[model samples]
Every structure is written in structure tokens, then in C-alpha cells.
Target: MASNPGPLTNWPWQKLGNVKYMVLSPFVANSLYSIMSKEERERDVTILYIYPFFLWRMLHSQLWISFARYQTSKTNHRIVVDKGIEFEQVDRERNWDDHIILSGIIGYIAVMYLPWAARMPMWRWDGLVLTILLHTGPVEFLYYWFHRALHHHFLYSRYHSHHHLSIVTEPITSVTHPFGEIIVYYMLFSIPILAMFCTGTASVSGIVGYITYIDFMNYMGHCNFELVPKWVFNNFPILKYFMYTPSFHSLHHTKFRTNYSLFMPLYDYIYGTMDMSSDKLYETSLKGRKETPDVVHLTHQTTLQSFYHLPPAIASLASKPYSPNWYMWMLWPIPYGFMFLTWVFGSTFTVERNVFDKLRMQTWVIPRFSFHYSSSRQKDAINGLIEKAILEAESEGVKVMSLGLLNQGEIFNGNGELYLQKHPKLKIRIVDGSSLAVAVILHSIPQEAKQVLLIGNLSKVSCAVSKDLCRRGIQVAVACKNDFYKLKLQLPTELCSNLIFSTSHTHKFWLVGDGGVQRDEAQRRALEGTHFIPCSQFPLAKARKDCIYYSTSAMIIPKALQNVYSCENWLPRRVMSAWRVAAIVHALEGWDAHECGDSMLDVEKVWLASLRHGFLPMVAP
Candidate 1:
């Protein structure tokens, strides 16, 4: 330790090559926020961690609630009540202090000295963006599934049902989960960390952005009144396929089994669990309509599922993969600690998620590396993971499952093929969802477009885009890497143009790309005055404001999820691959009601399908 001890010696290793990219890393930054050395930063980790969630909540929570109260006081929007249930004193009281304290306590433990889960904040814009992007997939998939899990007989009776206590909601209800439910939710946020570790680092702003996003969504969802202007959804109905409204969430609070989505309504729309009541409720709330909501208590077993089960707290622990880690020890004491903390802090604590029969639990860590990045041995690990997952599925007797994202590639490239060859007894059929997803992307296209500008690797889904448009006699302007002559040879001469950008008044343009020189060019051109359809998983930067941009991301959202915010990221996962499977399934099943299949896809068919399925129930996006 004494051999070369100094600032330089203590420094994190950095290559000359990497020095240029240090701004990309957390190691170097011109900003004052990153002035402290990392080791010293680690010492301050608890504070760093606390600020984003706990401290931020301290600053903003009361403000939102106060704002809600102020707004409500100013109008009938606050006093109008849901007829489904009467507001109780406990609801307001619980939100005012109980949830806040509980969140603080939980945040303290998670971001504190917990070696396994700690991630300090940083200010890099890229890190923040990467972190936000990384968490999108896992949160949507895991939360949607786990959320459904909470609605199961065992989980709902003891815990998740606690969240449903609000038939009519207020902003405070956003964080008003029981201890058990909150615990699971924190686990969901950790997905970004897992992603960060795999991608080599995390971003402070990214986590902050994600939290801000989810909490804002949570608050918006719980806010009793729908604040969206009816004219916006009516004038630009295409925007409705972007996300949930306060009324959409309010309906879920009352209906219980419907609207079980976390980030976007994609999962619900694809899975067909979207409650038809959402739009009407949203309109009712926005119009300042209110009625008493039915306060009928719904147990998961009785109201949703028929299976009798253990209490959720018990089920959560018993089902957890065995771990004798510090999380468990720290977790078991949380209940007692929570009470003590509440008593000491003088904040009231509710006994909602405290199921006595249950034990403390922790989510098993699953790294996102195999899915996000490729590696030497990661190939084997992915195969093994897939095999294990299949075995788990087989144990559960699930007959069919989709191999999503990276796993779909595992079917052909890695040991995934060997498993299929050797494990003949593993009768579960594995389906790749991208083909159907391509169909869905095709389906999301607008019918009125006479021409399409296709970007990115004009292969796979992009190729499908070319084919789809070409089949419909739509001119295709493709921007990709292949030699234009060679690509021209592969495609019909009449269908494509090497000049990727068109100055001519093309009726419509479609843009899609992954990171490359082509993507940059496409993005640049996209900023031009073209009515470009965004068909990527991520939102394009600096898109045109005046013209409409329909995204494949739109397919995941129901037309009812009215977007109230002006920040025009209508489809959040437009940059990430979150809902391709749902869109694929919906497209194949004619869930959008236009005839589509694996053999071929056409833009016109999809555009017509959009009309048929009411994909663009409104006018513009």
C-alpha cells in the first residue's frame, strides 16, 4: 500500500486512448459536480444516493401535493369524487407522511452502505440518457410481469391490494404502496444499475431522469383529475397512442385488473388487458366529472384468479431464489426499523403491507449484459440462461413463449441451436417475435403516404419496411451502408432510389436507424420539412415540430392513453426494443384487424390496418 501512494497512484487506471472519452466515463468531467475524487465520492455515496430519491422527494413531493391541493381548491376538479369509492381520512393522512417516510427509509437502505445496490449520481448527459434507455426494457417487461404476479392470489391478498386502496386517487397515492410493494418496485429500478454495470458504468442523471419520469407518471396517474385538453386528442388523435392519462390510471385504480402497465400502455395493449373504461374515465375526469366509486374490496383469488395461494409476503420470500446476503439480514429488520424510524421521525406509518406470515425477500440479480452487449463467454452464458429459463418455463408447464431480443438470436447463433437439437424432450415451442413485430411496424404506417424514406441498415426490419412500401407501389428512398449498386441489385429496380434524401415533394417519408454515419445523416435529413414516420425503437432527436411523425412505438399504446404533456416523446420506447413482441402478436393475430402474416408486409396494408384497428383513432401525433 505504501509503494506508490499519491493522487496519481491512487487514480483510476486510464489509457491515453480512453482519456479522450473520459468525459464519457465518470472519471473525468469539467462540471463542478464531478470535482470530487471517486473514492471520496464513494464515502459520500449515502448522501449522493439519498438526494436523488429521498431529498428530491422532500423537495418535490409536497410541492406536487400542494399544487394539486391548490389547483383543486381553485376548481371543482378537486372536489368531484369517484363514485366507486368514498375518500377516507386515512388516504390523505397516509399520503401526507407515511409514504414519504417509508420511501425515505427504503431509499436510505438501498442507496446507503449496501455494497450490492449502491450507485452514486453523476451529471453526464450521455450516462443519464444511457441509464434511462437501459432501464426501459427490463422495467417494462419485469414490472409488467411482476405487477401481474402481485395480482396473483398469494401476492394480492397480502400486499399489492394495499396499493389498490385508492379507488379515487390523488398525487400522493403515487408513492402510496405498501412496504412489500415498494420493496419490489425498488428492485425494478435496480435494473438500470445492472444494465450500467454490464455497459461499464451508470449515470446519476439517468437514474434521476428515470425516477422523475416514473414518479411524475405515478403522480399524474394518481392525480384524480384528467388535465389533458380534449381538443388535442381530438385534433391529433394519433398522439393518443403514446401513453396513459390520469383518467387511464384512475380507471385502473377502480378496475384493479386492467391498466397494469408501468411505463407505457404497450404491455397492456398487446396482452389485451387494457380496460375499455380508460378513455371514458379519462374524458370524465378531464371534464371535471366525478362520481362516488364503488369501494368493494377485491381479492386477487376471488376477483381475478381462481387459484388459492399463500399470503403475498410469504409467497414473495418463499419464491425468492435463495440468498444469504446482507440484503436479507437488512430486509428482515426493516419492518421493526420502519416502525422505529416512523416513531422517531414523528411520521405516521400505516400497517398496510405488513403480512405477519411473510419473511423478508430480495430479487435475484440477472445481468443485462447478455442481452445488451456481446462477449466471448457471454454466448455460452446466454445459452445456459436460455436453457435454464426454458426449464423453468417447462416446470411451470407454459406451452409457448417468445424468445425476445438477444435470446431470439441465441436460437440461431449461440448454443441455442444445440439445445434445440439435443433437448428433444424440451417440448416447449420457442418463437422469435421480430417477424411479427416487423408486421406490426408495417401496420403502424399511415395509408395516405405515397412514398417512404427508409433509413438504417436496410436489412431485417428495415428491409421489411422497404418491401412493405415497395409492394404497395410506394417509392422507397433507402439510407443504409450497403454499396448502392449491390443493394440496387438485391432490390427491384423500380422500388428503390440510391439518392436517400429527396428534395421532391414526396408525399410521405419513413425514417429508421441505429447508430452509424447513416443514422446521423438520416437524423439530419429528418429535421428537414418532411412528414417522416419514425419507425425506430428510440425517439429521434430534433424531429420536425409542425409535421406528424408516427412511430412503431405507437402500436404498443392504446388510442385511449391521451398524452397531456407537451414534450413530444409520444413513444418512449421508440429508441429501445420494449414492445415489439406485443405489436408483433397483435399484428399477426390481426389484433389491429388488418390482414397480416409472416410471408410479407406492405405499408398500405398496415396503414389500412391502422385505420381498421383504430390504431390512429385521432388525427395527428
Candidate 2:
């Protein structure tokens, strides 16, 4: 949206939501029908090519998006410097495919209304040559001047500013524009195609080739990386006048007053609108710069669908917390294919990059899942991946690395302590975040409660919560006798009096941990209005409608946390796991000690420090 919105700014089918693709159903059905019913010679080849061409364009854009993200994550030829992309930009650009849909509709109309368009030849060299000539002479010139006029206050505020909102550009940023503005652009670009038709030189290949060239140049210029080698320009000096680099268009976004040419820089050079620092920025970006983080959070995929929920996979799905749906099962094969790829050829990769009060932070994912950690044979491989990530973080000068999800499982890596034993002199601190997880669970318990039931597996977090509650003079009843005896052994003589063994389901509050089938059975046994607060990393399934289910241990991040567009696993937007937040608090406070492997920090101290650092506790539903 722009500062001052104008009429016709919204796409006509904007309200259709996901079903907006239905607009193309008619054309697709007709094309398929034509192919099946008409004779080979009688069928309109151009019309039949519309749906497939649309699919190709989509795949082409997606490849650019994935490639650009992968390249920028590496320390090579990145044009943007340390700038983070925000949620607003992601939401605004979510509709980038609308232009392709518009083009499909226009093509369908042209084929039905124009006599020559329905019978265009398959190939024509003359049409391709004419398209190049017209685009360079008229399309490029008109677009340059039209672009300048859009920067004028009236049009800028109402429309063009929407595209400029993203200072750190991505490949899709090129097609992100107001519906009204894009319509005018379509008119200008149509000059070449319409002229070819008028001159009786139009062909199916010529039209398709022209559109593909536009997509390539648009993505290349806006990709925010200098991939055009200097050797190309040096060998052919005249190419500089006809071509523009990513750095050239990048300046137009940052400086906002120059480099207004289309794909060709000829107009900008002739009109004196090119930025003077374009060459310097190009050279500097080509050399690239490395980014070292202050904190690194180590996590892994939970379920197979989580692969698609990753930030780079799909922007809209990543922005929301993931939940299983019946429709998602339709795409089961995709996740299976990705799982096989990761098992065979995957290593640790960066999932997200963030900033907090000038502190650089990144989330690095280990290429494994929960089920892999459970397997006896896969344990060493999972541990190896974790150890490798820790060493890499240390090499990158990271101050703290926190383990999240099953990455810190006791049976797998002894809650991330195995790395410390292997590399005893490591500088980077290891944090399993048990102290903060305990804090969140303790704070969630009601002060008026006299007693609470502790059920499921007893882990470091559950034990810590039990000790804290007993110190507050609250009775902690253990549901399982084995878990009760194990927990009692860890407590001092004084706190043992507060611990009780019981199998009753009368308790209104239950602190649960990991148990698959048994956990669900316990929920059925609990009384109405019982509040089940999860002390584990994974959330619990709500089995009874009468009972209350709270989220797993997590906290709402401070407003100052930058670039938080994607959700962290099952956690909601801006809500981070306590384990991840613990490392961030540790780095901000400059804590030197490692908080893993049976070593526990002060529960109250860690909780207060988290509050002082602006991490708010999640309010219960």
C-alpha cells in the first residue's frame, strides 16, 4: 500500500485470495479442449501455449528467488550491506504473480478478438528482430521518462512509493507495483508485439521470447547482487551503454533520484540521470563482504512438511505458524523427495538472519529431524552434524550457540554437552536454555494454586520446574511412581516433603513433558477445566475440549527485534522458543559460562534477566 492510495490501485481479483487462479481456469480448459478436439493443423498453437508459458514464467521467477537467497547467504557478490527485509515487504510483494495472471487474460482476449493473433506462425526471425528494435528505440525511451514522472510527488505518494518501500531489493521486487501502474507498463511493452502483428511478422516464438527476455532482465537488475563480470564489459566496451547491472539499479532504489533507465542504461546516460557512484558500488559489491553473528540458534526440522514451511520455500506459509491439514497430505511426495535429498547430500544451512539492537543473530539448521535423533544408528550422524555446526559457529566468531527442538535431546547429545567434551577449549558458549524454559513454565503456574500434577517423562526442565515450585511451598504430585522416585532422588531432604506420589486425576493444573500415546491418554483422564502447560520443547495435542491447553515454553520477543517475518516452528509470529531467547539474553548480558550438561543457571536470575532485556512472557490463552 502507498502513503496516499489511488483508485484502481488494487488488482481486480485481489479479493479472490487463493482461488484467484480460477480466473485462468477458462483459458486453461479451452486450450486443453482445443488440443484434444481440433486437428493438428487447425489448432491455434499460440493459444494452446498460454497455460504452459504461464507455468514456465512462474518456475523461472522461483528459480531466481531461490538462487538469489542462496547466493546472498554466502559471502560473495552481495549488493545490499547488512540490511534486513521486514514482514511488511514480504506481505506487499506476496501478490507478484498477479501481473502474470493479467498477461494471461490479455493474451486470451487478443487471441479471441484479433484475427492475425489466432493464426501466428510457430517461428519468425523477422518478428524477433523487430521486437528488439522497437523495445530498444521506443519502449526503453518511453519507460525512462515515464519512470521519472512517477517520482513526482503526486504519483509517488499515491502509487510508485509502494515499489520503493523495499530499499533492500529482491528479484520479485521488480514486478511488485500498483495495479494501475502495471497496466500502463503493459501498454508500453505491448508496442513491440502490436507492431509485429501490424507488420505481419508476429510468431509464437517471437512473442514468448520477448516476454522471457523481459523477465530475465527484470530479475537480474533487481536481484541485489553484482553477477555481471567486469570482464564482459572490458572485452566489449560498447555493451555498457546498452546494458545495466544489478548495482546500477540498486543505486536508483537507495539514492531514489537517478538511474531511471529500463533494462538499457543508454537513456539514463544520455539524460544525465545515472548515479556517479554506480561504478564504485559495483566494484565493491563484486568483491563481497562477510557477516559474523553475535548469536547462533541451532535447530532442526520437526516434521516433513516443515521443509516447505521454511522461509525460502514459500513466503506466505512461512509467515504463519505451521499446523497439519488434510489438504497438506496431497503434497506428501514433495516432502519425501526433500527428505531423501537431505539424507543423501545435505549439510547445515542458514535458515534465517536477524538483528536485535545492533546485535547480529542467525538461525542455523541441522539437516536432521526428530525421528532421526530417536534412531540408534542415526545418533552419531545427528551428533556429528551438531558438532560441525558448533565448530563452524566458533570459527565465525559467534559468542553463543543455543540448541533448539530435539537438537538438545539428552539421549542424542546429552543436551548439547557432548560437543564440550569433544572440544573442551571451545570459545563459543553452549546453551540448552533449560534455565529459561524453567522460568517460563514456573511463571505460567497460577500463584493461588496449592498443588499441581507433574506427568509424562522427567527431563532437566521438568526437574527444574519441580524444584522451583517446591521452594514456593507448592505441593508437586508426580503421576508416575517411577518418575516420582527418579525426581525425588534429585531433590534435597528439605524439598522432598513438598513432593507427593499420586495417580489421582483431580488436579486442575498439569505440567506435561514428552510422551506420545500415553500423553494423550493422560489428557482424557484429567478433570474438566484442567490447564495443561507444556514444559517440553514440542507442544501437546488438545484431546479434551473441556480442558485448557497452553503453548510450549516460549516468549514474545521485544519490538526492537528486526526482520522477524517468519514464525519459529509451531511458535506464533514474534514468539520465540525459550531456548533460542536464552542464548540471545546470554549474548546481550555477556555471560561466559556454558548452560548445558547438568549445569544449571539460577532460575530466578535468568527469568529476571530475560524480563530486563524486554522479553515478555507469553500470556496464556
Candidate 3:
């Protein structure tokens, strides 16, 4: 259960246990036996062998819990929670003691078969050498097949799923499994001995080393931190062909169905289960030590918005307190309205960069928060859910959390200022990443164009954008629901000189407002043009290739808000800019948010921040 975990490799008694298990278990048992009488010696010697193995497991689990609890390389999200769609941790923990006892018995049974009288030790270096060869060959190959079988839906539901419940693995997590799966695995390890004895190559010395080495490597695989330094594999290129590191196996636990080979990479490469991201994840882990982030970003889809993403969560909602009222389910046909029934819940999906860790990023998804939102009262409830996300990030030692898309409404904007004012003790800072995205959109606007058509030009953001374009030596045409300026006489000199009043499409580069209704037929016709930026002023209009595309939404770590409320909305740029900006802010917040100057012309510094921190667009090579 890992009831209480320490830091990685920080167990006070682990190295002592490892030394006793590997180098002295047999000798210790002999010393204890020689001191006893014959009858007692025989009775206790077998039991003595089990003690070292048991101690090793205890040490391994303790260290693993530490590694999992204090993962510095990346965040490790708990796969099993007390109450949620995920399997419950309590249910798994309840049977932990029994599992250890059964594993001990199985360990005793396996070791008892090896004859102690003719045991070989490393003094006969040949025995130790052969053991390594035999274990990695037959044992690793067979275990790969065995593990793949466990992933089958039938076996998984009954036996193997429990092990997978902890996606972010701790060292003890390597050994935690259903009794049936554990028993089957114990039997699999026995196959190496059976093969060696059958082939007349069995040596007790080799068996001892093999047992110790295999378990040690297994513990290393589940530590959830990369222990192998880059030089070991990079300088000695041949080792890369054979070795599997903690980052390698951790990916198996995470993405699953990849990197199934243990102890060696050879088999995984030969087989088809290796993940392309395995090496990248390893190098990322090796390089991810620059900064410690004090914040994380969270995003979600509303009920009607996330209706498709809700079946599994909703089906299991009956067991959770946040289940929707029956009436909400009745409105299922209405996507937006039905969302009112759901509550927000999310998990850290993966660890990203430490801000300047090569500037690469990691992310987590806050899948939901009480689904109903939009109305003034419902918005209040949504705000509470927003606080829940902030608190989660705060608990995770996150210093800052960035709001993206619908997460930052007009009332909820400004980096969750209300949250900080109300929850004075909560240390997490709120950031709206759009400051950078809007900067990008403003910076990216084509100043070379002389004429531009503006749709829903009366909207606040769009109106500001239009006036700014007029000031930038470009002609601006404004369309609005109500004619704000009837003629040139009514407009300011700067805008009236370049701007043309129009209720119809002008076919110039369009910067459409996110909202406001006017000349419905004209707007529809304007959308089909070869060049047009869609109705979102917040992400800004800076596209030329196509009329419709999803907004990239940010300057740094751009994100595509395509699945939920924003999916129907098109982005001017293909990549998700909003997510990128949020990703950048979440990764590290060493700079001041005040640097995002309000004036579009004064955005060079902010634009440089975007470029320096990877907030720029993903242009083709």
C-alpha cells in the first residue's frame, strides 16, 4: 500500500538489505544453521533463505514508495483514487499484507528447489557470468510474452488490472499485483531454473546471482526516475542496444502496450511493442533538472461540451458524490444544457519540462468540473470548481496555474484574482495565457495589406483591434449590429481616414469579432473567402492560408482547444497557441506577467518572450 513513503534511495536500511540479500544470504543461513543442532538446522535453513528475499522486497517497496511520492523528474498521477472513475486505492491496499505473505511463500518454494550443497558463487566468475546471460535471454523473453498475455481484456479484468491501477509506478509497484498474476509470474521465473537444470548448465551460484540481479533490475525499472546517467549509454553506444532504464519501463506503465521487454532493449526492438517516445522520454528525464515549477495548468470541457468524454465518468458517477441530478440526464439530448449535471474532475496526464529544461513541456488534463455553467448562478458554481483545480495544483507544490479558454471568463479572468483574494493562504498564482496569444495575433497581423474587413466590429476586443489597425497605416472596414459610425464625419480622424463604413463583405483580410450579430448573409459569404480570420478576437485573427482553422491560442506552449466548447471554433493557425502559452507559464513563471504590454505596438518585448520561450508558431521546416 505504500502507507508512508520516503524519498528515493533514501531508505535507512535498504543498502544493508540489498547487500545481505545479494552477497551474504547463503553464508548467513549457513552460519545460523552451523550454530544450531542438526534437526533444527534442517528445519530453519530453508526458512532462512526466505528471510533475505523478504527483506529485499521490503526495502524495494519502501524505496519505490519514496520514488513515487517524490518524483522530481516529472509528476506521477495516482491511477487509483478513493472515489472516482479510477479504481479505488483502498480496495487494493486492503489486500496488500496478504499479497506480501503469499509472495514470501512463493519465493521460499522457488528457492527450495535449488540445491544448496553445490551452490556456486562469484569466486567461480563463470557461474555469475552465465547466470546473467541465461536470465536476460530465456527469462526476459518468456516474461515479455507472459506480460502481453496478462494485458488481454479477460485476464486484465480478473487479475492484471490491479497492477496497472498505479500508472505512475513506485518501486514497490513493480511487485504489487493480484495474487493470481503474482503466482503466475513466480511460476514464470522458475522456468529459467528448469531450463538450466534440463540443459545440464544449472549452478546454485549462478542461480543466486540471477535471483539477486533480476529483482534489483526490476526495482530499478519501477523507480519512476532515471538512474542511468546519459554518459553510460551515450558514450558507449553498444549498451543502448541492450539496456532498459527506469524511463523505459515507466513508459510501459504509462502509455501501455509499448516497451514490454525488461532488462534489455534488444527484445523490445526485435519485437513490435517498443514506443518511439521511449528514447525521447529517457533523454527528457535526463535533462529535466533545471527548474522546479510551483504551478500547473488545468483545462476542461463543460457537460454538454464534454458529453462524449463523459460516458465512463458518468456511468461510474453513481459511486461518487458529485454525480449529476436525474434531471440533467433527462436533458442529455441537449449537449450544452446537459453539461450542467457534471462536476469537474481531472488528473495530471504527464510531467513536462522544468521551464528551462530544454524548454520542452509536460501537461495534465482537468477533464471536468461541475458541468453547468454560463448563467450568473451557474457561473458561481463553476468558480468554485475553478478553485478546486487551483487547490489541487497548490497541493502539488505548483506556484502558478494558468487559465485558458472558457476557464477564464470575463468575471473569472486576470489569473484568478478572485481566488487569490478569497483564498489568501493558497500560494498558487493565476495567469491568463491569452496575454501572450493576443500578443502573437497582434504581432502576426499582416501590416502590408492596405484594406481589411472587420466583422462584428462593435465588440470590445474587435473594436480595439480595428482602431489599432487603422492607426497602423491600413484601411479598416467595420461591420456591426448597430451602426456606431454612420459616416466619415462621425469617426475619429485616424480611423475615418483609413476606415470605410460597410454593412456588406469587403473581401479584405478579415478580423472577425468573437461575438455580436450583424448582416448574417454577409458574414456567411465572408467566411468562404480564400483569406479570413474567424470570430475569435481573444485568440486574434492572424491567418492567411485558409478561412477556417482552430486557434493555436498562445505564444509559448500553444494548445488546441478542439475537443470541448472550443472545438466548433476554428483557429487561424493550425497549432494550438493557447495551450502553448499556458504551457509556457505553467512550466515556469520567473518573468513578470506585467511584461505583456497592453498597447499592440509595444509588444516587441512580449513577442521576444514568446520566441525565447517557444511561444512562436510551428512553421514548416
Candidate 4:
């Protein structure tokens, strides 16, 4: 019987989790060891002497953890809570490790008693060391070539990502990928040994030892430990000559295409894959470097709370907390009402009477804060005003004028040909992101500039650029609802710290866009602030939303959201985008969310709808 004293008491789930790991560790080790040959059971000298070392290196490599933690500590310059995931992501790919361990053990066992014709012949004593040296170069060279192929256009999705899965790798992660990849490496390394030893031309013991050494080297390389001496780094003109280090390997993991050679730098250099400028190569140790902003660090700090959670020492500045009550539930009803309205408008309204049908297709119109200006006629009127701005800019020196989101080059690409015909000399450099381009412009821009025109997302981009541009005797002009830019300028530094708007002290700005609705806390803050141009006088009309297409299954909504946020391109591919709108239209016409889940776009909608639905259920699970 269980030892629970009362109905209210039970074991904490965390304890069971810890208990599971402890119980499984030895079972796993013993099970693996059982498949390997023991000293007494071994027949060949190679099996007796060298093979054990190979097994040792593989098992130890798999088991190792402290080394990764030590390296992470040195790199981040702080005590790290979890180094395993970081190691897995950086260097040791997940499936690769599983492949190595499983194939090596299974192949060894399966062929252990094969006839002399079938089995790998043992390496002789004399050639054992020599073969290790000779084979190392060839093995590495082959790896470099094969690795390069894996990254080629076709194989990348299936094979390369298995390794790239954990950009930071760990010991267990070292050989833990798909079986085929492991078999590939095995075939490359083992073929020479089998050929040499089969004819009694080479020592089997040396072959086994070489295998062990290579595995050890691979393990240590991914371990991220700076166990090698400082003198080695200082004396060696080329660190790759000594041995491939974590820094050398990590850069390959981070920048996948460069540095494919393993074991030796010769092949990589000869093949044009060697990276000479890796930041990690300069360091004698992983110590004393800025922290890498990887998932592990954030997981430790925010998710796990193991990094260090120091309570704020200062007393609370605000007085009372909001009470949990029925009226508080009223706040939740607003979103439901909005969703209900959307559903009603989308489904109940006839096509001729539908407000959305009045709007033009493939056209950008500014959104207004209130329903008073939500008419399609008002939308058309706003579009005409923006057209006038474009015409005015075209008539003058600003020949390549745009009204909508200019960051998306596609928008410009579609319409840019018209402008190029009008003004051949006008070179418009559209700024997309402050992080990528504006930073360059901020540093590179001439200090003598008098006036600067800023547009779009005042909270993030325009405001950020304006502040930097202002320092160079530049006055900033924003195409926003006058108050949006003006209020941003007036915001307290604390609220707007690290933002360009915080630096601004003026509100004498032109209203170019329709006033923004206070949809969330952020917008509410902007609305209440004194900087905004009044909504009534606000100017421009432009669409804020973009489209997305999901190419995969509709089942992967969470993954879709993650892909949307985590992927390199914020915009979906054109095919995917078209499918997304089509999916929405299908959904509005009484199609079940699942029924529309044929394309990638439907997948995203299903996912988003599920997330939205999670909040709407009246009763808790």
C-alpha cells in the first residue's frame, strides 16, 4: 500500500521525475555494456586491447555532462543552471549521438562471430599507431565532403537538420540523430580499417584504438570544455593543427555551411570550407566572454527560475491590488463580444450588404480608431489622399513615394516599376528593420542633414531611427496620426527608454495616418499620453496586416506559431499567403476549421483559432 497519510497528500511530481532518472541511468549503462565484449570473452588482440577503449570513449562521451557545464560557465561568465540543452543546440546534434551509439554497438554485436571472410580483421601491433595517423586524415577528409553534401539543397531537410537541431550540443546529443547518418560516418571510417586489416596488411588493435581515439576526439570537441592547455593555443600558429576544439566546432554549428572538416583542418582548407575568423578560435578558454543569448539561458532565467531569482528589496510603490471578483470577469467579455461581432458580420450578413465587400481588393486603406470612419467610402477617400501624397512626392524630388508598409520590399517591388519610369535618378532605400539596416544608416549617415522623414511603427522603428537621426542637426517628420508621434515624444524616459521617441521634445508634427485604436495596454498608454495628434485630425489610411501560408499539416498550429515567430522571414511565401486568405474565406462560408485544413494557411488558422478558443470556454478543465 502507498504511504500517503491522507487524501490531501501525495508525492510531488518533481520527486518522481528525479527518481525516474536515477533508476534508469544504471539500467541503460548495464544494458549497453552487456552488448559489448568483455576482456575474457574477446578472441582477437584488437578486440582484447583496442576495442575496449573505443567502447569506453563512446560510453564516457555519452555520459559526460560536467565538461559542458564548465565550458558554459566560462563562456557566459556566470554559473549556468542547464548546459545540456545549450550543448545540444550548439554542437551535439540529437539524432547523431543515437546513431553512433546504436550502430556501433549493434554492428559490433551482430558481426562478432561472423566468419573471417565476413568479420573485420584485427589491426596488427606494428601498424596500429601508423594506421591511426594515416586513417585520421582520410576519415576527416571524407567527413568534410559528405558533411558538405548533407548541407546541399536536397539532403539538408532530412539529414543536416538532425545535426543542426541542437546548435549547442552535449555528450548524449553527440550521436543521437537518425540511424542512417550514423551509418554513413561508420561506413566512411570503417571501410579503410576493414580493407587494411582483412588482408592481414594492418593491425586490428590499432584500428580499434583509432576508432576509440576518433570517438573521444569528437566527444571532446563537442564538449565545449577548454581542457586543453593555454600553451597549446599560444604556441600553435593554427589551432586546427593541434586538434579541432569546441570553439572551432561551435562556429561550424552556428554558421552551418562553413568549416565542414572534422579531425584535421587540411581538408577544410583545401576544400574551401574552413572558417578563419571564428570568434571562439581566439580564446584560450571558454571563460570571460559575453553570454550567448540562446534558449538555454532564457529557459534558466524565465522558465525554470533556477538561474537566480532575487526578490526586489524595495517596498511596493503602489498600494492595493485588484480584487478577484465577478465584475473583473466583465473584462473577459469584451473579446468574446468582438469575436461574436466578427462571426456575425462574417456569416450572417449577405454579400451585397456585407461591409467588407465595399472595400477594394488588393488595396491598402488606413484603419480608423472608431466605427464612424469605418465606412468603405471613408476608406476609399483615405486611399485617395495617400495617392495624392504619392503624386505630390512623385511630382517633386521625392519621386519614389509610398503610403503603406514600405518595409516589405514586395509591396515596393510590385509598384516600384511605375516610379522607376517616372524618376530614374531617384534611389529610394527602404528601411525594413532598425536592428539590421537603420543601425547601419545611423552610424553611416552624414551629420549635416537638416530634416529627416520618419514613417511607420513609431513605437518601434520610426521612433528608434528619429532619435539617432536627430543628433545630426536633423528634424524628424513622422507620417502618423499627429498625436501618436507627438505623444511618443512626450512620453517619460523610463516608459520609452531605449526608444527614439523618448528623446523627442516636440509635438508640432503633421497628421498623416488615421488615429490608432487603443486595442491593448500598449495602445492605451499611447492614447493617454499627450504626444498623439487628435484622432479626428489624424491623416493617412494604410493596412497594417499581412498574410501567411502554412504549407504543412493543419495539425501543427503551435508549431506554425513558433515557425511564424522563429523563422528567418517574417512574411510567408507567396503561395502560402494566397492559401491563407483562401482558407479564411472558406472558413467564413461555413467550412469547419478542420475542413479548411488542406493547405499550410489552413493549419495556421486552425492553430490560431484553437489558441483563441482556449480562452473562450466558459468552464475550466
Clashes in predicted model 4: 49
Candidate 4 regions off by >4 Å? 1-58, 73-97, 104-124, 199-205, 236-239, 279-281, 284-287, 290-621
Best-fitting candidate, measured by lDDT?
2
Which is superior by TM-score, 2 or 4? 2
Looking at candidate 3, the ten consecutive residues that score lowest on lDDT are 560-569
- Write the residue-wise lDDT of candidate 1 on 1-621 in tens digits: 112122221112222322422322231121125335455544444334543465476556655654554344233354244232222423222333344444455555544445544545475565665665655566777888898887787777666555566565657667755545665677787677566645645555655566677777777767666676788888977656556677777667777888888757767887998998777666655677332111100011110111111111221221222223443453455434533453355321111110001111011111232222346555665455556655655564544434433444422343134555556566454443344446556555667766666655343456555665666776666544363444456566666653344343343555565444224444454434565544444445443565555544434323332211111123331121223223333323333121111223343444454445434422235
lDDT of 4: 0.38
Candidate 2, clashing residue pairs? Answer: none
For model 4, how does the per-residue alpha-carbon lDDT over 1-621 read when each residue is reduced to its tens digit?
012122212222223532322433443454346546456444333323323544565456534543444334334422221212421142223223334334345435434444442334553654564465556666766787888887875566665566566555544445544445656777787765665545555544555566667767777666654555557767876865646666667667777888777767667777677787644453635454453211100000111111111010000100111112343353465434534564344211101000112111111112211231235454444333333333433343321112223212222222223333444443331111222122323433334445433433343323434555454435555544562446456545544332232223232232112223222222222212223221111222212222111111111121112111111011221111211222223323333222101111232343344334221111100
lDDT of 2 by residue, 126-194 (tens): 998899999999999999999999999999999999999998888999999999999999999999999
| Ranked candidates (TM-score, high to low) | 2, 3, 4, 1
- For model 3, the superposed segments whose C-alpha errors exceed 4 Å read 1-292, 302-355, 358-364, 367-371, 375-377, 391-397, 411-417, 420-429, 456-464, 481-501, 516-523, 527-530, 535-579, 582-589, 594-602, 618-621
- Name the 10 consecutive residues with the lowest summed lDDT in model 4: 310-319
Of the two candidates 1 and 3, the one with more favorable TM-score, higher being better, is 3
- lDDT order, best first, reads 2, 3, 1, 4
**Alpha-carbon runs more than 4 Å astray in model 2:** 81-83, 325-330, 517-519
Q: Report lDDT (CA) for all predictions.
A: 0.46, 0.88, 0.52, 0.38
The reply for model 1, stretches above 4 Å from the true place, is 1-53, 73-121, 230-241, 289-621
Question: Per-residue lDDT for 1-621 in model 3, tens only?
Answer: 222221221222233532323433454455466547556435434445556666665555544543543353343322221111122432343233343455455545454454542332324455455556666777778888888877777666666666777665546567666545656666767666566655556664555556666667877887666778888976999898677888888888777788878678777788878889888888877665544345454555434424433211222221122223554566466554323334323233322222333343333334343233345666665567677767767775665566655565544443356676677676555665544545555555655667777765343234445556667767777665353464344457656778776666645476655554333444455545434554342433333333543333333233321111112122322234443454454444455332111222233454565566545554311
